[model samples]
Structure formats: C-alpha cells, structure tokens
Target: MQVSSWRKAAITASFLTLAASTANAAAGPLDPTQGGAGGRIIRVTTLAKDGPGSLKEAVEAKGPRVVVFEVGGNIDLGRDVLTIAEPYLTIAGQTAPSPGITIIRGGIDLKGHDVILSHIRVMTGADGKPHFSDWEADAFSSVAAHHVLVEHCSFLWALDENMSASGPRFTGKTLAEWRANTSHDVVFRDNLAAEGLAFSSHPKGEHSKGSLIHDNATNITFYRNVFAHNVERSPLVKGGAQVLMVNNLIYDPGHRAVHYNLMNLEWTGHPYVTGEITAVGNVMRGGNSTDADLPFLTIGGDGDLKYYGQDNRAVDRFGKALPMFGRYGETKARILQQKAPLRSVTGIPVLPSGEVETSVLQTAGARPWDRAPDDIRVLFFVAEGRGEIIDDEHQVGNGYPKAAETRASFNPAAWNLDTMTPRSGRYPGDQTGPQEKLSPRDAAMRQGGV
Candidate 1:
C-alpha cells in the first residue's frame, strides 16, 4: 500500500484526508469519534523520547494511524511535553509489554480532536525545578481539543493540573462561536488522576490541581474515575462549562474536591455565561491534608453554577458525613438547584456512591491488571484511607520503578487492529487467575519478580 498524507481542510473542522482506511474516518459529518479506525498501524519500536520509531513520532505522524507500543517501561521526556496536534490518532498503550509504557518527567498534551488515549501512564515529576518556578505540565490534557475519549489511563505526579480540557474561549465572536471553538465533547472515563504535585514547578505555590475544564468547554464527562491526593480541582469547572461527573472517587483533596469557579479577572470583558454541572453518585472521602470542613462541591466567584445531584457521598477520614455544597466567593454566585441540560444529553450510567471506591481501584488507570509501583502505591493508599498532598513526586512509591526495559515485535495477528485489543482477551503481559485477586502490595512485589 502506498503511503498517504493526512490532509486538513481550511474551513471544515474534521474533514482532512481521503485514505484507504479499514473503516473510513472523516467520511461524513462530525459524529462521535472512532480514533484512527481506518488508519494504518504505526509500531513504536523504541522508547526514545522522539525519533522515527518512537512514540513521539507516531503521535506527530501526518496521516491517521494507530500507534501501538512494542516496548514497555519508562520513556524519560526530560521535562518536555509531547503535544499531539493531529486528528484521528489512537494511542494503543495497552499493546506494550508488562509494566506498560510509562512516560516520566513530562506529559502528553493534546491539541487536535478525534483522538482516543487509553491504557497509558504518565508520571510527571518536579524535574529538579525550584518550588515556585514557572514550569508546569499535565500528565494528560486537551489544551484545546474536542471529540476525544480518554479512558483507563493513569496520570500522576503532575506539576499542574493532572488533566484538563481547555481552549480559546472566543475564537470568533458571540456565544455560539465561543462554544464552537472551545474544547467540547470530551470524556475522561475509567481513568486515574492522582498526586498532582503541590508547591512544585508551577510559578504559583501550591498548584496541585486535578482537572480544569476551562471556560466554554462543553459536553465534558468525567465518569467512573479516581482523583486522589490532589490538593484541589478534582475537576474545577469554569464559566460557561457543561459537565457531567458520575461515580468518581475523590480522596485527600487538600482544600477542594469537585468545584465550580468562574474567576472574574479571567473573563474581563466577556459576558458572564452560566455553567451547569450534574454531579451524581460520586464519592468524596477526606484524607490526610484535607482541609477542615471541606465541601464536596465548592462554588466560587462571578458566575452562578446550575447544579443537580443525586446520591452523592462526602465523608471525613473517620467516615463522618460532610456537606455536599459550599460557597467561597460572592453571594451572587449561586448553586441553582436544577438539573443541568447536560445530564440528559449524556448517557453515562452512574453507580451508587458506596461502590465507587472499590470499582475505581479495581479498574482505573493504565494496565490495571499489571500496575506499576506508583499506581499500586496510590491505589493502596486510597484503599487504606492513607495519603497526603505532596510537594514532589519522589515522596511516594520509591519514585519511578527500576524495571529493566523490555520490547517485542508487533504481531499483527494477535491484536484486533480496529479496536487495538488483543485477540485472546489478554495483553502482552497480562497475568490472570490468582494474581487478579492479589493485594496492591503483593501485586507490586510480584511485578518486581520478588
């Protein structure tokens, strides 16, 4: 087959190229994304930060392609961020060997839409930066993106917000234009965002945030995920955002958990647009370093947040009940007791809050069946009701794992290329049976060949 270019139209948002895809993408009007379904397979043969056979190259490749990892272990990014600006890209991180691919000292930044990021691990350390330096990075984020699905990935030790959906609020003029341009139709489901680095790298002191759904970012769903040990912003929605948060476990938020804040200064001349948040069947448990009397959802300045909730649970370390809603800013910033329009738009099923902790720990994060040490440590901490906000990543989990690097060839016959799932219902190093029921510590020890 001849190679083809991934074209982008000047006017149309998603219509880019015409390639002979297995299942044609960009064939019709914008629909829900099927990441790189029709594209050719691009094997990542090296764990180098960038180069012909590296993960960076696969993401930055011109045409639609499914990026599969043959190599596993850490790829030290050396404090750099790999921005995937192309559309129709599928990063098949589950294809890697045991321990899976872990990106260290950096992050994956998304700008283009029509992307699926799954089964990946990104651990962003402080990188030897001073406490109040200007440096910042998200383990995974949509800087300005849409039509994306991020699932079953692990994001931790971020210098700033661990994950975010953000973009230029006003690319054109008027409300419709703002909504069209900003990040929308983005979903973070069955993933993990934990241990955002406090008091490190970011210029502002104490910047351990989870997800920042920026102004005007609409149709955002955070479902069945885990947010732990982050000081704040276990997803803070800004002005004009539409969001659905369901069945997520939030632990050890220092002064905040799930919050809605529309800072006035950030809006400046723009008209204040109301944001709506539907938080249902979510669990928030206070842990060490959690602020006294922390609310599950805190409403802040400038804009009123239309809110609705059902069966949400918030408790202290001792299992004492906590308030579901609180206000920190203006008396005008109201939490309207009404169901958000987004609640009806999304179809994410909600589990009871009581089951969230167990469900998240079992399935959240990259390669959950073969967790790396840091993931095990974080999940273990959450399970034991122990953990704290940290200024640096090395404060936990013996830092990064010291596993010897491993690699293998791409055996096309073993995987379903369209879905990037193994044909045998098992990944490269998946160990089922008794190991499936092992404790996190035992799993870690076993993973280390001890």
Candidate 2:
C-alpha cells in the first residue's frame, strides 16, 4: 500500500514537473566548468599531426580547456589511442568550422575528471580499413572517470563497442581498490551510437554491443540520444547504483534495447552486486528484421536487480506500441514495472513524453554550425527519407582541408546486413567518415591563428 501510494505521488510530481516546462530540457552531467582553470578555451588547429592545436596534444595538455576546432578533417591514428589523463577538459566540437569536424580513426579514452566531449565524429575503422590491432577498441571509453559528459556526437563502426563507461575488472581485490575503480557521475546525452561491433574479449556468439556501463559504474544518466543498429548492449546497465535512462530513441536494435546484468560474467568474478535502472519517457522501435519482436528491456543474471519504468513507449515500424514483458512471471514483472524507485531523483530535469521524439531527432548528432535554423529542424526528417541530402562541404580559400571522410549514406535497408564481416554498405550515413566541407575559418585557424 505504501509503495502504491508512493508511486502515485511520484507520478503526480513527474507530471507536474513536465507541465511546468515545454522546452527542450538540457541533459547530461554538469558542464566541465563546474571545476578546473575557471574554464579556458583551447583551439585545435592540426589535422594529421599530434602537436600544437591537435586533439592528441589537447588531451595531453594540463588543466581545464574548452578545446574548440577551427578546422574539419579526419585524424588518422594508425593504432594509437588518445588518452586524457588530465582534469577539467571540454572538447567543444561544436566550435569547428562545421559540425563535420574532427573524425577520428583510432578511438579516445577518457580517464580523467570533469570532461565534456561534444560535436565530434568517431569512426573506428575508417573507409572499411582495418586497425593495426584488428579493430579492438571503442570509439569512446571511460574508466573510473567522474563528472563526465558526452553529447552531440556520432560514433560508428567501432571494432568493439561504440561507447562504454567502465572500470577495471575486480580480481578479488580489496575494498579500496574496488571503490577506486568505480565510475560515478557520468552522463551520455544527445548523441548517436550506431552499428557497434563485437570483437575479441566481447562475447562473440550473440552479443555485439553499443554502449556498456560495466559493473561498479554508478550515477550514469543516458538522455535523449539515439542507439541504433547494435546487436546487444544498447547501453547495457551492469551492476551499479543510481542509473537513469530517459527520453532516448532506440530504433531497430538487434537485441533488447537495454540489458541489466553482469555483462561479462567470467571477468567480473562476483558476489554480484545489485544494479538499478530507472527508465522514463523513452521510445524503442523493434528492428525491421529478425530483431523486430525483441523485448525492450531484459533482466539477466541472478543479481538483485531493480527496474522502474514510467510513461515509456515502444513501437514497431507501423507506430504501434509493442508488448512489454518480463522474463519472470507476474510478480517479478510487477516489480519491474513500478515507479517508486525513481522518486528519490530530485533536482534533475524531467522531460515530457511529447518533447522526446523531436528533441532526439533534431539534435542527436553533429549539425552544421551555420545552417539555417529551419533547415536544421527539418534535417532529421530528410535523413529519415523525406527530402534530398544537402551538400554542405566546401573548399577553404583555395584548397580543401585534407581530412578523411566516410561519405556514407543512411540506409535503413541495410539494417540486417552482417556488420561482423567487412562490408562497407551496412548502415545509414557515412560508412567510412563524415563528408562535410572544412569551414573557411579553418584557414585562419590553421595558420597559427584563432
């Protein structure tokens, strides 16, 4: 009775919160400005090298920096991984000459505190070229990092997962080490993670993953993003405390949209800890192929897991709500469907159900910096097959910037193609890299300017 009463009260409060605002509520971790260097701006200049104005150099630079781009191009990292070990950094990919700035071949690792990554595109194996390591890394990964934000980016064709938040494996370590390895206060928002892969170390048979929040990662919020075309682990919720997935658009994933589990059972070696996920105002559409009828959420492992969902919608291709089911019988399903656990989340923004679809579509990935506002509004519909694709790439003063481009198209027809093999014609958008013109400002920025 008390739980029912609590759920009713919380539902009322959530509706009231939603009614109070009809705006696109900003999501994700607080900006990197919450701490460090009082927020300084560092402009990125290089495309092919790792020196001054280069993203690699920016990662190695000390202190908090709002790392902006003055050029747009791909950085070909043969097998090198960019590691950010400093505190208080913000990679402002939005400040580039265009939204198509900074496509990376090798992946990035966020192993620091108070970091924000935005507006960049990460293509793990560019142009279907293999990495020297046989494509064994994610586009973006974190370990024990705190107060991080990843937004307005696109990650595709990763050798492993597209994006992941995790820490070290527990090898029967002490409590201090365990505590030290836990990731907390992380948020992934307004991004696109598509066509993630499964490779060595990731379960091979039935689990190619998208985003993973591994065991011991905590306080994560996934808000208003697109998770499309992955087999499993579309933001898998492993053992953690306080995870919130809200207002996300998951379209056509090959398996369950969200999995609550100890993902890698062999590696975790656990007296498994309980994991919690609170889902709200989210949407999922089953794939057009064999995965069309999969469950939206699944509970795996025997851990004491908790799922509290409210005001969520799942649809098929025809816009019909899909059946929501629990793996266990009625009693377990009732607990998973309740809304009481999310009442404790106060002060965070609550998104209304109506706003989620448009918000996610219009702002999910990189957009042109100077395109008309109206065009930007309609771009998602065009990308989903309404109008013709626009050409925005341009030549700087005399010549084009020398960055690699994916130049791929969005092909929903290829959703069922086996991504495991090395065929380039799989997903929508650029399969190799982004194909946008370098901003004219790139010339000024590249000449030791800006």
Candidate 3:
C-alpha cells in the first residue's frame, strides 16, 4: 500500500507536538557543566596579524586555563594544525570585542579532556583547493578526548570532515595506540558546519561531508546544529558507542543525509562491532536545485549498526516528506518511522526535532553581536561558490587568494540567499517561526548587549 505525503505529515505533526512540549518543559544553556568554568582567565589580547598571541600561542597554551579573546578577527595558521592538548580549558571566543574571531587555513585538534569551546569560527577559508593531502586537515577533530563541549561555532570549507570526532586515525600508529585513543562524552550543539567539503584526502572531492563520527568515539551528541550545503555524513556514524543526533538542521545536503555503518576492511581496515544511534527530531530539507534526490539513511558493513528513527522530518522543495530508503526490501512509507533498538544516553538532552531549524537559525555560527555585514556577506559567498566577488574586506579568514572554491559546477548561493535572507533580530536567518526560545546563557548575553 502506497502512503500519501499527507498521511506522513499527519504522523509527523503528532510527533512534533509531543516533542515540542517536551522541549518547552526544559530550558537552559547546554553548557559543558564540568570543565573550565571558574578557571583562570587567559585573555588573548592581540589580533596578531600573523604570529603568536591570538594565533597559536594562546590556543596551544597548556593546562586548566580559560582562553578568552580580547580582539575579534582572523588568525591564519597556514597549514599548521592548532593542537589543544591541555585539559580543563575553556576557549571563549564570546569574550572577544565582538565574538567574531575566526581561525582560517588550518584546523583545531582537540586532544584534551574536559574542554569547552564556544562562539568560535573555524574555516579552511575559500582557498582550500583539494590536494591529495586534504585528509590531514579538518575544521575540528577530537581524538580520544573526553567531556568536550563545542558550541555556537561555525565550520566551513573543509577539505576533510567539517567537525569530526574520530578515534586514532591510521598514520603508522600501533593498534594498541589506536585502541587507547578513544573519544567519549563529546557534545556539539548550536553550530553551523557548511559548504565545499571533500570526500577523503584523495582527489575524489566527490563526497563532501559536514561531520563524521568514526570508530570508538563513544557517547557523542550533536544537538541543534545546522549542517548546510555539504554532501554525505551530515554525520556518517561508523562503529562507535551510543550516538544521539538530535534536533539538527540539514539544509541542502547535496548527496545524502544521516548514514550509519559498522567498520570492515574497506575504511577501518579491521572487523569491528558497531554501535547504535538514535536520530530523533532532526529536519533535512532541500534548499537548492543542485541538491540531490538522495536516501534518508544508508547502512553499510555487517557490523550490527542499528538506527532508531523517531520524529525526524525531510521535505523536498514543495515541503513534503522524502520517500523512505533502507537496505534491502525494508522500505517504509515515511522515513521518520524507521525502527531499530531504542535507547538513551544520560546527560544528552532530547529537544524537539521540530524546533531544530528555529533553534539553529537562532544560535548557530558566531554570536550575532560579533558579526558585521561583511561577515554575513562572506558566509553567503563561500557557501554558494561566488568566490570571484569576495575580497579581503568581506573575507573572514586568512587563507590566501580568499576566493570561494567549489568542486561542483552549479552554484546555489544566488538561489538559496534569495529565498532566505538573514536579518538583525532575535534569530540568525530571518525569523522563520515563532521567536526561538533562548537558552539561559544566550538570554543573559543578549540582554547584556548582544
């Protein structure tokens, strides 16, 4: 029996109502309550046009320190990776003059424990042409890190995964070392990860991804983030512990949506048992003509990868639920009701997936006070591949040439921007629905001045 889109909508509507009520009952900032608070404030006072202070030294400083920025601007790491190995650290870009700080041309590697990073922007910038060594770079990577919270950040134009939480990668590391490097208790919330990503380090450039969670990364949560303009892995979860992907907004994902897999020899080079993922209250929508007609779920390997889909929503241009897709003949009517084992991880918040678009639009990327008109312009330009018109004034990062680079022929900026214009208000992009209810920290910041 064929299912009508309207019937799917009705089921989704009921689920959304329930989820919304649950979210409404709970209200607070999703802060990393355990680390870096009440720590020593290490103020980064310089906008170092090129070297220390704002660039590398402060970011790489060791120990339980709160790294706060005094100035707001760009820091280009030039092919260098800023490795944060210190535990109990708080990198607060919100403390900058305008919370508009951006890290460009390089990536941030979190190899520490109990770290909290908020209101920061990490971009490879527009000039990251795909090289065979692209895999060496990523916007943000967590390696065996624990109790980390990455919130209200912007990650763009990554040659590899935009924001990834992976175990020890294969780089001549011993198997025991790889097993020892396990990431756990990480949370990525209210962030924007967008645009022009490469598949792997190789020149394929075919599979642009937003975020990837690889083997042994356990108990990770992605909540209320905007995964925009990338292809696959707007999280692809491989073998891991429990993963909760809740209330995320995927706008114009080019190839596919959330995928889960167990690892075999192809990628991990080892046989491994997979973990379970509960994808709830997420929304995926097509925003451009270039967006592909892709599956909502892709399962690979035979590693017991289980998925529990509840209250998720997908819409085409006309705002209808997408046709469902799963392996074999297990085709369901609505993609939202896919069945697998249902479980929960403690400390993971269950916000309504219905509010994902609104919540992300309100809080993702850099804080509103820090962004200038030029910053907004750059975001639009890079996402759409309109690199030719972008100049130094509009560029936020320090990558050379400062022009948008796209692997795809067709650009979608002109069309997507026309449909959605960001405005100065309580939300990020034009107030799409009821003013998003702000978290306590967000409300305090906005009331204090923006």
Candidate 4:
C-alpha cells in the first residue's frame, strides 16, 4: 500500500519537534543575568566547607529553578543539609544516583510544597555509637507537606533503644513516632529501605496517612525492593486507613514483617473504614522460626481483607512468609512461581520462536531472618522455572502455573504443611534470575544491581 500524504506530513512534524526539544535541553546553563529565562540549574559539592549553605542560597536566589547537588566524591550528611527553609525546589544527586547524598546526622525536614527529592539516600543517625534505639521520628519527615515526590532513594537503619517505651506515645518516642504527623500526596517510588541494626518498640494507634508508595515511579518498572535487618515493635499502619504498599522486599530482625489491624467493614464498633490499600507483586522474607505466629500476611481485629493480593512471591531472607494484612475484601490474590530458573524481575527475555518468558525471578538474595519460619510458600511464574512447593507437611512439584499462561490462587486456610505441585509451562531462557529474595535488594538489583 502507498503511504498517504497525512502520514508523511505527520512523520516530518514529529521528527522536527523532537529535534527542536533536544536542541533546547542541550543548550547548557542559562545566563543568570538574562530575564524571563525561567528554569536555572544549581550545583552542590562537598569540596567546599560552605557547600550546604552556598547551595541553599543559590537555590533561594535563583527562584523556581532545579537545584542539582553535584558531589565531587561520596559524602555523608555531617548535619542536616538543606533544612526546612527552601521549599518548591527539585533536588537531585549527581555524583551517583541513589545512596549518593547520604543523610547521616539529620533528615531533610520537608514542610514545604512541591518538593522533589530524587536519587539521594536518607540514612539513620551515624553517630558512631551503636545502640539499640530507633532514630528520632522519620529520617525524612514531611510534616503537613503537599505534593512531594521521593524517587530512587534509600531509607535505612531506624533503630530504637530496646528499653524505650512500647506503643506509640508522641514526638521523639521512636523513629516510628514521627509518622504520627499527617502528610498528604506523598509519592515514594523506586526507592530502597532496610531496617538496619536492632531495636524494639510496640505498635500504636493510627499514624501516617494519605501517601502513594509504589515501585514504578518511572517508565521502567521493577519487581520488588529489599528491606532487611530492620526491627520494630508493631506494624507500620494502624487503624483503618488507605495506603499503597506494593512491590517491596521487607525483612525483620526481631519483629514481624508487617502487622496491622484489619478494618472490619461490617462491624459498627470497629473503627474500620473502607480504604484502598493494594499489596501486590512484592517479595517478603526473613525472621527466625517459621511458626512464630508470623502470618505471611496478618490483619488484626474483625477488619476486612480489601484487596490483599500477592503474586509471584518469595520468602524473606530466612524463607519465612513475608508478613502482610488487610483481609477486609476476600478477593483471591494471584500467587506466582518462585523457582522460575531465570533471574531478573523485570525484563524477561524473548525466545527465538518469538515467545517471551515471564517467570524470571525478580528478587533473590540471602534470607534476612536469623531463623527461617516453619511454613513458608514461595510462588513463582512458570516462565521463570518449575519447582516443588514445600511446607511443614509435604512437597508438591509444579503446583501453580506461570502468569504467562495460567492463573494461580492462594488459599490462606488450606496453606498448611502440604506442598503444591507447580503446573508446567514454557519460559524464555536468556534472562537472569532475581538476585535477592528480599524486595529492596531485588529492586536495587534491577536498577543496575546495587
């Protein structure tokens, strides 16, 4: 068929537009003296003693510009860099992508609007003194801030002293204490977190709310991110509230992987509210003793299991079911294959016959748990590989089929000592398998194996 005139014209227009846009971005930094230039670029370096202040001043003076923190070498946060003063600024790390600008002493207290923190690391207080204590509130606390985007970053090591009071108190109780402050429209995507060190605390009432936490913040999506060696008294979310917890690798040194009160949609006395919480496509592992009352997923009270979905799953570093909750909605979740032979969570390979293998392992690594749980179920996609399901009682080979062909369902009631056999299928043989079983590690691996 002959090409039409409209097609030719459209192709020409698209090429010209792309060329013009490329030219504009490549024009280098704008002249400071020029008016109406709009966007300006600011750089931060550790070479100078006055690096943080100088960079902050430049950002404030530039007015509505992108402030790029360019580190000459790897630098740790001496004190808190970029305090609560500068708001509405897009901050990005340059020397390296994530774990580049490590916040050792203090967190980036976000109280402003439209703040974007990308490719940075928010670490715990590196005081050089090892103690069993949690960090003060949040490493990056956004108190009443709006429209904040935290992408490609890492939040690790928020340990509290074991002797500290259990349960939620108020400010400064523990790192979890900081989450009590309300913040809205916060997006945490493509980030990694580990609960470093060891501390103990208890779960309290309703805390942080209104946030969209996912892995696919950018165009290229990943499977799961790993979080190991973290300890906590109780679960992250309490009471009935809406939060997006997906594609994450969570491990526990002492406490359960996840603990939350299930919202009872039918009960009048229960404070259960209809919330939209999606726990899909994540890998949870770790914790000692398989039969430690660790529900691969647990929800407290008579709450509802509203959309509790887990597919293509794996155990923690210790081979225990990654703990989870929210049974308000009884919709059966998709369980994927765990032994898909191939590595790599995202980017499954295409075969010579034009077939794509989707059973690739997204996350693979050592067990985070000091002791592995007794009953653990690992779900894998058929395209990745075929394997047997093992529990306390027996082992079943080729139990569930791969997502590329068939659908797998999880029965919490029937998930005892019986191993389920995986259904056989075809998968691409080229892609590598997941590097780590934990979500955070798997997530980091996908992004060039951190």
Number of the top-ranking candidate, with lDDT as the measure: 1
* lDDT of candidate 4 over 1-450, digit per residue (tens): 332232232234332221111101222121011111234555564423244534445445535555544342223444444454445566544222222344444445556656555445544433443232233334454554545655445554332211011122123343233333334445444344433333221122111111112111111122233344344322243433334444554443234444444333423443333223445455544444223434445444443434345352445444444444323234332222223322222322111111111111121111111001110122231222222211211122231111121112222232110111011110111112322234687678778779
Q: Residue-wise lDDT of candidate 3 within 1-450, one digit each (tens)?
A: 332232233234443332221111112334333455555556665655344656356656666666655566666676667888878776766545433567777788888888877777776643544445444567888877877888768777676677988765443355445445677778887677876444434355454677888775666888878776676687887754567787787777665677766545544566454466787888877655224455566666555655687788887655767754544233221222325535553445556766556444544565533443333543454334333211111233433323221111112222111111112112122212223335588878977955
Q: What's the CA RMSD for each of the models? A: 8.4, 13.8, 12.7, 18.6
Query: Which one wins on TM-score?
Result: 1
- Could you give the candidate ranking by lDDT, starting with the highest? 1, 3, 2, 4
Off by over 4 Å in 3: 1-33, 49-52, 126-136, 169-180, 198-204, 266-271, 289-292, 327-351, 372-450
Each model's total of backbone clashes? 0, 11, 2, 79
At residue 287, give the lDDT of candidate 3: 58
C-alpha lDDT of residue 17 in model 3: 31
| TM-score against truth, every candidate | 0.88, 0.70, 0.70, 0.48
Q: Look at candidate 4 and tell me the lDDT of residue 29.
A: 21
Write the residue-wise lDDT of candidate 2 on 170-244 in tens digits: 623764466457667787876777655433223232234678887767778887777766677777776544578
Off by over 4 Å in 2: 1-39, 126-133, 169-180, 198-207, 267-269, 326-338, 343-345, 368-450
Which parts of model 4 are misplaced by more than 4 Å?
1-38, 47-62, 74-82, 95-99, 126-137, 160-181, 200-224, 232-235, 262-274, 287-293, 301-305, 310-450
Error of 1 at 319 (Å): 1.2
Global Cα lDDT for candidate 3: 0.58
